[model samples]
Target: MRVAILASGNGTNFEALTKHFQSGDIPGDEVLLFCNHPDAPVMKRAERLGVPHESFTVKECGGKEKYEQRLLKLLKQYKVDIIALAGYLRVVGPTILNEYPDSILNLHPALLPSYPGLNSIQRAFDDYKKGKIKETGVTVHFIDAHLDHGPIIAQKAVPIKADDTEASLESRVHDTEHVLFPAALKKVILERMNKQ
Candidate 1:
């Protein structure tokens, strides 16, 4: 399987996915790193990892429609079979969603249906601080049009320590995502392949 990672942040998850795929521990070829922000640090990591990369913002492409058209074209160019969103913040429009369908996956920092959308880590930590919740975790799921409201592929609960700050809890959640995302992706793809 050929996979493309769409990311916006520090690219730690992007880096993890690249290494996992390259190591042959996972059964896919990570052929591209697609970034919505041209200057995102993930592009730098992609260069170091020797993975081909492409980037352009929606504004740079004129609008979301045109941007998605270009995005679809690029995916076709790579013959991409999967799109894994690491930290890509933008909502995926219908064009790409219709093209990839269930082939798109996203990693959310909080155990979702509770804290969906942005700032989820902080929200979960706040809930914990208020004694409203005991733990927060990571979730890897198939993304739909709804933000973070997709069908879950995998989830792992990360306990909140009494001494844990938001940063500590966030670090553990991220680590869990790094592991879970790749495994969940591999599982999804393998299942898809077998059904073919």
Candidate 2:
């Protein structure tokens, strides 16, 4: 499979995906990294990993339509088969989503139908404080137009510890993501890979 990672944060998950797709169990022909934020730490990780990366935000491209047009052009140029959204903060527009369809996968920090948006880990911890839940988990889902509301590919729960801080819980969740994402992606890729 030819894979590309779209991310916006510190790039730990981006790094994880790049490395995992390059070798280990499920290898790919090439793995690329693209970011909306040019200066995000993930760009640095991309440089360190020797992965080719491209950058341009919606504002940089002038608007959503233009931005997605540029993104679509790039994806076509690379012949990307799978788009893994690791930590990308932006909601993918219809253009790219329509182009890629089920080929795009989103990694979220909390189980679906629970904390679906930003600060999910913090929200889960807060809910625990409120005695509303006992555990939260990571989810790898096929993204649609909605935010983190898509068909689930895989999920793994992480129990809340009484002594655990929100930061600690986030750490554990990230660790789980690193494990779950690649495994789920391997399945998705092999299952959906276009037949020659």
Candidate 3:
């Protein structure tokens, strides 16, 4: 399977995916790495891994529709089979979601329907402090028009310890994401091949 990764941050998950692909833990290859931020660390990771990388600024595109159009054009140019969102902060528009449907996957730091947006780990910690939340976890799901409301493909819980700080809980959640994301991608690739 040919995969493309979209990221806007430090790219820890991106690094994990590339490491797994390099070590043969995942059968697919990362054909491209695209970043919205020019200085995103994922671009450096892609360079270090010798994978082709591209960048586009949402500002340059003038609007979400035009930006997504450019993105879809690039995905088509590479014949990208799967688009993985790794620390990609933007909510993908309906156009890409409609075109790819279940083919686009996102890795969320916390379990679904709980802490759905940015700073999920911190939000979970706050909720726990207020006695509103009992558990926190990572979720891998397909992308849809709604934010983080797509069908969940995989999830793994990370218990919040009584004395756990936000940073500690976040670390655990990220570790789980690193493990679960690759496994889910591998399964998706295998399932696609089987259907063929």
Q: Order of all candidates by TM-score, from best down to worst?
A: 1, 3, 2
- What lDDT does each candidate get? 0.90, 0.89, 0.90
- For candidate 3, list the clashing residue pairs, or say none: none
Model 1 regions lying over 4 Å from their true place: none
Q: Against the true structure, what is each candidate's TM-score? A: 0.97, 0.96, 0.96
lDDT, candidate 2, at 5? 88
When 1 and 2 are scored with TM-score, the better candidate is 1
Off by over 4 Å in 3: none
Cα lDDT tens digits for candidate 3, 1-196:
8999999989899999989888988887889999999898888988988888999998999988999999999999999999999999999998788888799999998889778888889988999999998899999999888888888989999999998988888888889999999999888888998898
Query: Per-residue error at 173 for model 1, in Å?
Result: 0.9
Higher-TM-score candidate of 1 and 3: 1
Q: For model 2, how does the per-residue alpha-carbon lDDT over 73-114 read when each residue is reduced to its tens digit?
A: 999899998899989999999999999888899999998979
Across residues 1-196, which tens digit of lDDT does each residue of candidate 1 receive?
A: 8899999978999998888888887786888899998888998999999999999999989999999999999999999998999999889999999999888999998888889888998999998889999998999999898889778999999999999998898888888988999899989878977887
Candidate 2 positional error at 121, Å: 0.5
The Cα RMSD in angstroms, rounded to one decimal, for candidate 3 relative to the true structure is 1.0
What are the RMSD figures for all models against the true structure?
Answer: 0.9, 1.3, 1.0
